[model samples]
Target: MSMRFGSRRQGRLAGAGVLAAATAGAALVAAPTAHAASVHVVTPGQSIQQAVDASRPGDIVQIMPGTYQESVLVNVPRLTIQGAGAQRVILKPPAAATAQGGAPKASTPDTPSTAGAASTPDTPSTADNAADVTPATTANPCFTTGTGICVAGTEGHRLKGVRIQGLTVTGFATYGVAATETDHLVVAGVNASGNKLYGIGEQKSVRAVFVRNHAADNGEAGIFLANTTQEEAGALDLDGARVSGNVLTGNTMGVVLRRVRDMDVLRNSVTGNCAGMFVIGDENTPRGGDLTIRDNEVSANTKYCAPNSHLPFVQGAGIVLTGVENTVVERNRIEGNVGTSQMSGGVVLFKSFVGVPNTGNTVRDNMLSGNAPADLADRDTAGKDNTFTGNSCSISQPAGRC
Candidate 1:
């Protein structure tokens, strides 16, 4: 799919105020002063982790145009990790580790029992079988944690205002970039590919922005966002988090949003995946909803994915919404997604696995074609007050919906 959609122009304008404020905050931290933050430059054969560890808060770690083999952890708030460019700066696992594991490839999803034993199916697991030789320790958590870049903060002390941009991270066992308990985090202009699990993942975060990135050929979702990774909980109010202008392809699913609220999924190009997008909720205290999904191109997602413990086999699913309420899906172009799975369609509204029905959701004004079974499928007979209107499509499951 081409990433040159004009939707990005409108999407940028929609979030201009918030993005500008964030840029201003970052500038103040980067300004020269008595205790001025320094810029640490790392070149080929140098250690990115060492530079990160040696830097103070608000410092910029600038990586030159070269390949570096190491896992980096950024825990300092208001820090910026800038690379020369995604095409120029490359980050991968160490040569020894690569030799042992024989390079990462897109593989079938592992079963829950053999996968990350402590993690839920909807989240990235900690089991890094590919990098099992490097065990995780207090000092090098990113090594065995199976993450190329990790930005972590404790629940009691959320990391704030960290920016990671202009890099290509690949060949990890798990996520290309993982962040937890972070606020105002920005990940932009990165390419995340060939990871065993999710390309980019974030949990327990608020006001996060993922923009202008490319994610492809990952084992699981291109981008995974959730309330929590390890435990079941109520939905988190994302406080205006945004996923905009990204290109996602060749993963099991393009983007998976689980138990999150108040976010925007806008202007993304999603294609050639098993499923385009999944908006998932369950029987939690506060149900997930109140989000906007708009202006994206979702097409040709026909790759078949086998069923895991939490979900049925998924294929040809343009946008699947389960157990969500008050969500708006509008102005998207969905086409050429064909499959036999129950969830397959241009836009599907199915009941949650826990039998929770969708309520008060709206699907309108979308352009859809060539979707098998139906362009719009409302399989949740028990769902309440869900409306489908102004959609331009050929067919729908219960008839007269198009």
Candidate 2:
């Protein structure tokens, strides 16, 4: 028994020594040290791809002043490629020059070689270059700014620290800036207009931030967001976005947000658009919860034809709400461009979904006047679980709560 106790004590002492050594080692390794890396300067002929390839996951790519008329794909994350400013680094679309990489690939993506497509000179233009992207002809191309269509697979992606500030993004093969399956994206001081689908289509759970940007004169909705699938249950914090101080104008539907949750919209000006702002939810299956639409001044959002885009008329609704729940729309000044002959609905609460009613929403203190609200294709709910008060409405006409 004595020997056994001695052996047990020895084993405990050995374990304690191992634990002490591990803790000490962890302390030494996990000390609060700054792990800073040097930035790589991308010069002429040195592409962002090359800089990124040379970087080790955490390095910053500082692009100097130049027009990089090349498309790029970033599969890596956690790296910062910051231009000197919005004006410095210009990211253009990938064209035939880069695509028909006929010869053997280069050692580094940034290396300029006269042997292959890198040797080709870039002909730069403006957003009008899409008309020139035919298969047979290669026109002097420009970046897709201010507008375009959203492609099939690239609906949502993250774009951060990228500045098209005064530049335009239009005529995309897809949406100007599609942000789906993306998160924590920051788009500031950029101008996105005249795209095929939407200026921005945020799908899935993208916690995006749009500040000091202009989304105007686009083909379809200015900013459109669709919800994710049902497998992502309890995706509550999936997105908590903020859109502030932005201008949206002259689109099919302006700033249309569908199937999202927990948004903070403040101090933005909406004007001269088809529908100033459209907010709705996913009615078919599971919808989002906990949305806050407040402090936005929505006015002068006029109406027109589908207007240079291929979208349907049913897709246009200013401040339109569908099968949404647990929302608040308050304190917004809604006026002007209420209705014309073609465009209707200043703000619409359309419970047109087949199954459930868009319930549990509260709207208060919104100066909802001078706009034509959507006449329900039909009506069922007698304002249950939804409170509408403190809103200045016209009790006579069918517009603005009349």
Candidate 3:
């Protein structure tokens, strides 16, 4: 492995954790109140949907060990869906909606699974590649395409306190676990893999805690946080989001934070993807920042989405900051991110938007090595007030900056 390091003389930057906590606390003030207590037990071959339909706010739906082939949407407030264990309980899409049930759909000509210009001669062609295709915007892709578990709340009814734990969600056309316009949600110890889009995705949600989860081998991002429009973002708390102790790999991006704020992404293992954590914002409404990315192992992000995909055609990076501000990257192990483009590196800061350059960001005290092009890259002239201090690296792409 070719290792390169870049930095000026180092000093300790304090209160990173404290700032993260304070930011998270400020965002939680808008969270809804608690719900009434109720518990419902569901076994295999029984209708989990029926149990969900009968449930009220603050109800706990405990599921036993079995393969439940149904797409469940949780709209009830404060609903807790707990399985026996991630390995014991499996939630798959229904047979009719599954990609494997009928005639194999042909891969898109531009898809990575197909014989594209970028595809190697030895690339194995398979029907499983069809699972990675993007779904339409007019419908709920989970039902139309397929999804394992979804916590959906409309703009009028913003669901609160929905908790999902100990479940393995796989073989879905859309997301394995998805949520929108919800609050106070906890997704723990879940294995979300082999899904079409993201392994886990949340849009316009608040106070979410994703802990001890494994999100891998998805088509898009492993864990995605998106706020596309202001109306959708308005329903979110934007306070504290806790993403920790998770293994994210084999996806377009490990964790994608777009137009999200006040998040703490810590102690996670992110690797073998196109890019690790991406903190992005733009000139549009509800731009995101205020993140603390620390204490994680981020490496070997060497995959990219197809050119025809809706996602940006970004290559490997341990972490990327674009059009974002007031963010911190500290105390992490970052290395080995050689992408298709020369911009690939351990960490990259760029101005993704025209007027809104990435500014007021700090890259401090990170252990970076073995990254191609260089360990650190400052790729935009618009990026201002950015500081790289105390990072233990040998060189940067631009010579004198280090």
Candidate 4:
């Protein structure tokens, strides 16, 4: 009996020892690692891409005052790229001579190739000649065509919390700024101009804000938001975008939203483009929900025809809503949208061949004047559900009085 009792006691002690060993191992495995944030200052002669490559998440890349002839691609989360000032910090493509050969000519002192890795701000940087082998064209496939700044993400790898501030991005081959499948992004106080395509392009992205920026002289729209679809369900995720307090001019369209939802376009000055704004719906991607356009100064957008562009020339229009539903246009100063075409007007609504009608749209209490032919027009066959009320305009089409 004594031997049996001693064996039981030893057995219980062995079980307790095993459990304590397991607990100790778990505590070691679950220990947290330290993540330190870093600040990398990029001077005139340092390569921003090299700085980005050395950075982890939650790092700041500060660009000093100079012209950087390079395209940047940012895929890291919680990353901040700040410049000294918009006009002082210029990010442009390499000169055509440098871009063609993918090497610096050694004649230009400011080439991006001569720019080395990151250094302190007190250390003056050499000019760098940029190459295409870096992160320049490494955006999403939908946004790979652009050359300025591309912020993108892939499946299972979502990037968020990015801020781009106080930079002048210009003279690129395509879009000045392209954000694809990203979220919580902010593009503020930047001047994006003279690109071959959109000044700022957001595709399949959500919760993006564009404020206090200037977009001009782009080959396409100043600001474009589209939902280019993939085979998966919910692939086109264009939602919760706010475009306010910006100046859009000298593009094909100032602002264009296709298949976007819950958009607010307010307090913007859109002028001197092909069309001030366009909300289009088509068969592949249907129109989205709850668009509000108010308190904008939309004028003088009569340059509707351009070469090598596919947008139909809709003459003399401040805003055009086609095949859209549940939209509101109010309190805008729309004037001087004059053209010889019969379809030209201050605010026009039309239908497309997509079979979805423009229903439940409200055009009310807008200040309109000097618009040629009319101040408002409804050319949709299924335009019965739309309401036009309390508009302060001289002339309206389809025999309406407001």
Best by TM-score: 1
Q: What tens-digit string does per-residue lDDT give for candidate 1 at 264-362?
A: 999998999999998877778698889999999999999998887645788899998888899999999999988999889999998876788889999
Clashes of each: 0, 29, 7, 10
**Best to worst by lDDT, what's the order?**
1, 3, 4, 2
The best candidate in terms of lDDT: 1
**Cα misplacement distance, residue 301 of candidate 2 (Å):** 1.6
Q: TM-score for each prediction?
A: 0.87, 0.64, 0.78, 0.78
Q: Model 3, 63: alpha-carbon shift in Å?
A: 1.0
lDDT, candidate 2, equals 0.49
lDDT of each: 0.80, 0.49, 0.68, 0.67
lDDT per residue (tens digit) for residues 1-402 in model 4: 011113433333233334423443353346332465677999998888777777777677888999887777888876777776666788877555244743322221111111111212111111322332244444324344435677877655657867777777876655678887788777876778877667887776888888767788876678887654222122244466788877787777788876566878998889888678877654344444368999999999888663222234456768877767788999999989887553468898867545555778899999999887788888787765898998999888777746
* Tens-place lDDT digits, model 3, residues 1-402: 101111210000012223323433343344443644566899999867778879887667889999887777778886778777666788876654554662123222112111112222211133343443323222342222355677877775668877787778887766788887777777876778877667887776788888767788887678877653222232123678888877888877798887677889999889898888777766554456778999999998988754553234667777888777788999999988877563478888866634467878999999988877778888867888889988877668675444
Where is model 2 poorest over a 10-residue stretch in terms of lDDT? 106-115
Better candidate by TM-score, 1 or 2: 1
Query: Tens digits of per-residue lDDT for model 2 on 1-402?
Result: 011113433343334334433443354355432454557888757776666657543455666766554433333343444444333344444444225431111111100011111122211223434332333213211112211211112334443222112233443433556543455555554455655446665555456666655666665566665553212222234357877776677766667665567777776777777666655444334565467778787776665553322222432334555556778878877665456333344455555333345588877787766554342111324334866668775531233343
Instruction: Provide the lowest-lDDT 10-residue window in model 3.
Output: 4-13
